[model samples]
Target: AGGQGEGNGLTQLPCPLGLVVDQLGTIYVTDDGNHRIMRWPKGATQGSVIVGGNGGGGQSNQLNGPVGLSFDRHDCDHCEENTDWVLASEPLSHSFQTVKLTHHLLWTVDTNQ
Candidate 1:
């Protein structure tokens, strides 16, 4: 029910490389061109940055060239309280990381590192 274009909102997604849907119908996107991860609530008009989106850097909260994403469903000791972690791959930085949704924290656990 809307148009997508160049702006600072849901309509403005540049080079979005990855997409995923959660158990509750939330949509997650890796806005590669913008160097950020965006979260769109079901039927929402705009998306909010869950991670990155603060320019590119190696900081704990920044992401550069995020390319892929997935939910970690395996039952591992690192997962607490049955929470699924979101894994993101930033190819340009040669990095892969896991984000803990419960605490909204990003961890650098890329095998390439």
Candidate 2:
């Protein structure tokens, strides 16, 4: 889903750290350098940001050094249902944030708590 260099563009990835694929082969990538999560559908040359595209920060819409990702299976059995939640690890913020598949910020869990 990325090209030759790091960038915020659909075909670029800057320091991509982690990724997960759904049952339908849609790939979800954690773009750490860009502080966003990218969704790349199978057979697509480009991808779209599904979370934290507003640069690195502590805000609900931002992600600081998002390093890891996993799908929360307890909420939904399938990713295509748009009811599954993505758990993202934000090392820079010392927290984990949950983003619904519909691209909504659900909540954040502070590791320090």
Q: List the candidates' TM-scores in order.
A: 0.59, 0.65
Model 2, range 1-113, lDDT digits (tens) per residue? 78758768889998888777765687878888887878788898898887777877655666677766655443221111112444454422334456545554444233432
For model 2, where is the 10-residue window of minimal lDDT?
A: 74-83
Candidate 1: TM-score? 0.59
lDDT of 1 by residue, 7-83 (tens): 44655786777776765576777777666777777888877776666675545566657766655443111211112
> What residue runs in model 1 are displaced by over 4 Å at the alpha carbon?
1-3, 74-113
Residue clash pairs of candidate 2 = none
Position 113, candidate 1: lDDT: 20
RMSD of each: 11.1, 10.9
